[model samples]
Each structure stands twice: as structure tokens, then as C-alpha cells.
Target: MFAKTLSASHQHGKRLSEPRIRQLGSLVTWLCLSFCSERLEICDFWNPFRNFVNLEHLELFADWGRPRKLVPFSAPEYGLTQLRTLKLRGYLPMEFVQWLLNEPAHVEELQLCVLDFPGIHCGGHGEPEQFFEAIPPHMRDQVVMDAIEDRRRLRGLARFADYQDKAIAPRSLACLSFDTIRRFKKLNKLYLYKPAAGRDHDDLEVYFSVSSEFRILLEWRDLILATRNTLEYIIFDQRPVCDLRESDDQAEIVCEVSHGDSYKRFVDIVLPTLIQGETFPALRMIRLFGFEPYEDDPCKEGPQEFELLGESENVPALLQAAFPEAKITNHIGRPIFIHKKWGELYGGGDVLNDTAGLLTIGEMIMY
Candidate 1:
């Protein structure tokens, strides 16, 4: 039955007059057009589809597989009333992002690849700020801005600091990822890459000063207070600072101190506070990476067994004891232990290794 409809549509296109063609174009489910050169006069072909009231998906390609100037295609007439997804491949203008945000009621998912601006140099001319301001307030939370290897273009994003202080500032955003931390009000999830260590203090100070709505993930924890209480997941990626010199290395060896002491301070002081009942009432998961075990000190230990310092095998057990009803799964290359309640709730696992063990327990809870 579906095949016949397609066949009829193809036949109709062949026999239809130009006026009829315009009518049929308005009902197209999908449209793909290519221009040989940026100057190609192809406005008529686009006009019909621009009025399409039911376009669910759209893809527009230009330059005929070569680098050429492209023109902006207006979508207001396309009746994006029912459009669910929109994808643009090359040279998307700033106006495109604005258009998607304006039609918040119809678009559920939007992917924009600003292929022309590989370095994302739009910030130099104030385009980045202008682009962000054009985003509809209601849709800011759902937008994801992705750039590739373009740090210099984003350096000036701190300019938004002034706008953030306004009374009618935008606050519906639930997720945001940018090259810098300037102004964020209701962010819940964030992903940042390769941040400069020198800028760490300022970045953290900005976030910590604001109230966290839910979760935050970043490379450093310098500003996280033991009392913030709202964070659920914390991940740290420790890479040595670029400015360290031979003299700095020599001092560290003389003092017999590891350079990672600052990170340890955060874990020791902040981590324990989260597991306590008074903080993070909904805390469920805790993950620590690149962790080194505590070295034996004359004052600290007996026969070397897996202890809490470097080998955190016992950390999960301590947390389970504190939150008796919580599910605790220690991720240390294997499934260490599961409390009886969690075991029954998630499905019992062998003390050693059980692949499907946790799933069974989760299913029981749902039923």
C-alpha cells in the first residue's frame, strides 16, 4: 500500500502543471536540493517547499560538493508547524539558530554543523553574543552548541556576565556547554574540554557562587564547597600543568610530596560530606577516576590489605552502612560486594563477577 502511494506521487510530479507542482510541493515530507554554485538562481524551487505545512525532516546541501558561498534559506513559510527535526550541513547562518529557537513548539531535536567556521571565529565580531541573544528564552535549556577545536573563538564569551545580572535574565536552560564559564543559572549537566589550569579558580568561583539545580561535571573541583549539597556526580581529569619547570619538580621531590595533594584534599574533605545524611539527600552514585592508593606510613598500618586510602574497596561498604537502604556498587574492575537489600533489589551477584546480576535486581524494583 505504501509503495503505490510513492508511485502515484512520482507519476503526479511528471504530469502536473507548474501551479499544480507548487501545490504538491507544499505537502512534501522530505526535500533535498543542491546548488552548483553559491550564485545559482534556484529560489523558485525553494519557494514551494518553504510553504510546505508538513515537512517532518529537511536537508539542504549547496556548492555541489565543493567549497562555495551558500545563501540562507528562510523556513518561516515552510510551515514548520509539524517539523520535528532539522539538520543543516554547510555554512549555516546565525539566523538559522534564531529560527529554530523561535519555533519551540514544533522542533524537538535540532543539529547544526557550522562547517564554514571551523575555528568558530564568530566571537571576534560580536556574532557569538548576538547569536546567543537571539535564542528563544524558552528553548535555551534544550540547545546544545558543539564546536570542534575552536578555543580562541570562545575566549570572549565572558562578555555575557553583564547580561546575567539583569532582572529578566534567561533561566530556563537546563544544560549548557561553552568554551568558558561566564553566566549559567539553572544548568544541570555540563561538558567542557581541555580547560586551562590558570583559569580554574575563576571558573569554579562563578559556578559555586550560583545555586546548582542538580549535577555538574568538570575537570577541577577547586571551588566546590563541602556544603553545596546539590551536586550528584563529580569527575576529575588531572593533567599536569604546562607551566611546571625543572625547579618546581625538584622542590616536589625534596619535600617528598605528590603534586596531586590538592585533589586529595577535595576528596577527603568534600566526598565524605556528600554521603552524610544532612547533605545530598538524593545522592545515589559516586565515581572517582585516576585514583592512587595511599602509601604505607609508619603511623598508619599493619599487614598491607586493601584499605581506604589508595584502594577504595571499602568506600562503598562504608557508604552502604550509612545509607542502609541505598544501592552501592563499587566500580573497582569487579563487583566487590552488594548489600542484601541492594542484592535483592537489583538481583544478587557473585562476590566475584556476574554480568547480568545487577539488571535482575533493577527489574524487581520496577515490578
Candidate 2:
């Protein structure tokens, strides 16, 4: 049978039209809803989909209207007994995380892209023990929770600190980002995006200094020491900027970028003593994006190779020398050098320069 997609919207006081709920109620497979309305209670519209017995995928998008107590009975109920994926977007409460961890054992992937929450700040120093505690022990190992664009919300949790002190296993997780993996003691595979710009330089340094965010890099390093390790891949979608120095008494702002070769000076001067050897050992595959082209002669040459920031043949070579068995792939706009594991994938044509380019990376990824 073909999969079904359903969307619903309501104005202030009107109930969801009967036809809308009926269309979703009859679906036996996948269900997706992008709903926004000030008048309709989200629970009222969601109640019908809970009856589906054959749902394999379910997605919901909603906004914060009122605080609904997390109840055991009101969760989405797919009928097929084969639901494996759930994706939710909006200002999800901590209770939503609890519901996902409480979901049936068959669900394998749970993605939460929270655009806004009451108190969370992106890349902040807030403990998420209460949030993590909601995850049941058995379900913890089987679930992969992805939190995109999450900010830390660290205001009034002193009373909850005692519950957050316990440790949990990390192997159950597959892909996690932001602060989710920072507090996680054991993570198997991690995907890191570039940090957003416009953060205070001093605040950035202080946070990274204390948080476990850099520890993931260290853990990957340690995997190289032990032959038996869990980490298989470390994918950096964008380069991370570590040093942001503002000119004193001058209007100049200087930011230092860190990656493979370009970051050697920063690493030697600052990171060696701060970060240990095992920070990035277990990495077998490194995928880099958003690169600048390399110029052969600084005085006269145009551009030769498209070199990814912090990721060059030299850096990959260093990693290979240390690991000896890992495969390093550098993806640039076009092909450059030949390595045992290097291959180039062409990006969309120069239509990007045109006022109206037909292709974009976001569109491509969605397509």
C-alpha cells in the first residue's frame, strides 16, 4: 500500500474539520502533520492519529501554547506495530523527551529539532540530568535522539541537581548533536555542525574550557589506542571557530579558525596541554565541508585546489600516520590529489553566482 501524508490547520476557536481528522484516521502507514493554530488545542488534533495501528513513521510540528502534562496514554499510537521513526519540531518540553524514551522498543530513530524552548540557550553550560533521567535504562541503548539548534536553559534547577547526578551508558545512541552529546559519557557516532557566529568571544572560550564538548574529540583520539572501540565515524559538516580576538582600542575583530593544517599554531599553543591525546583517536572516516580553494603562489597564482579549512592532505596524512588503518576522504568542489581513499563529488554548477540559481545545498539535501 502507498504511504499517506496528512496536514491540518485551525484558526482560534474552530474545531479541526471532520474531513481532516478522517483523512488521517484512515491512514495505515506513515503520518505527517504541520499544524499551527491558536484556537485548536494540539492534543485535540493529535488524538485521532493515536488510533492508527500500522504507523511506521510519524512526524508532528506544533508551537508552545499551553503546558500539557505528559501522560502515558496520550502518545501517538501507530497501528502497524512497526513504527520505527518519529520526528518532532517546535518548542518541545522535557516531557516530550520522556515520551520518546518511553516509546515502544521498536522505534529506532527519534529526531527532535527544537527551534525554540522557554529557557534553553545554544551551546551553554546547563546540566540536563533531569532530561536524561527520563530516558529508561533499557530504551537508552536502542534510541538515537538528534537535537538540532538547542540552546541551554540553565536558570532554576538547583533542586533537581540531585536527580541529574547519575551516569548513563552512551552506546545506545547513534547520532547526536549540540549539548546532547556533551553531557553524554559514552557516544558511538557523532555529527558536528559548525558553530553559529555572533557569540561573545570570551563566553565561547569559557564554555568550551569547562564543558565536555571538546571531550568527544578526545574520545575519538583514544579509540586509536584500544583496538576494540565503539566509535566508527566522525563527520564534521562545518569548521569550528575556537579563537575570537577583538582588537584593543581598535575597531578590528579577528577570528581564528581551527581544523586540520590551518589550526596547527592554535593546537600547539593552546590545545596540547588542555586536550589529551585520546580526544580523536577512534575516527576512521572524516568528512569535511565548506572549504576554501588553495592558491599555488600567493604572489601571482590564482587558485589550484579547493582546500577544506583545517582539513588538507597533510592533516589527513597525519591522522593516517597515527591510525595507519583509517580511511580519510576529503570532499571539495572538484578533485585534487590522489589518495588511497580520496574521491571528489561535484557540487551544483556555478549557477550559485547567478541572481537566481536553480540549485541550492538546502534544496539538494531535501530533494
Q: Which candidate tops TM-score?
A: 2
Candidate 2 lDDT at 158 equals 20
Task: State the lDDT of candidate 1 residue by residue for 1-367, as single tens digits.
Answer: 2111222233323334555555775668776544333243322223334445567766553222223323334557333556655544333344443443343344433332222222223223322443435343543342222222112224544336532321110011112223212222221211111111111122122111011111111112212232133333333322111221233332122112122332333344344554554544444443332222223232224553323322233454665676565454432111111112101101111211222122222342342
Clashing pairs in 1: 50-77, 50-78, 293-310, 294-310, 345-361, 346-361, 346-362, 347-361
lDDT of each: 0.31, 0.33
* Residue runs of model 2 more than 4 Å from their true location after superposition: 1-12, 16-23, 26-28, 32-53, 59-81, 86-90, 104-367
How does candidate 1 fare on TM-score?
Answer: 0.29
lDDT of 1: 0.31
Residue 208 Cα positional deviation in candidate 1, in Å, after optimal superposition? 29
Q: State residue 46's C-alpha deviation in candidate 2, in Å.
A: 6.6
Candidate 2: tens digits of C-alpha lDDT, residues 233-269:
5443322222323332111111112233223322332
Off by over 4 Å in 1: 1-21, 31-49, 59-79, 117-120, 127-367
Clashes of each: 8, 24
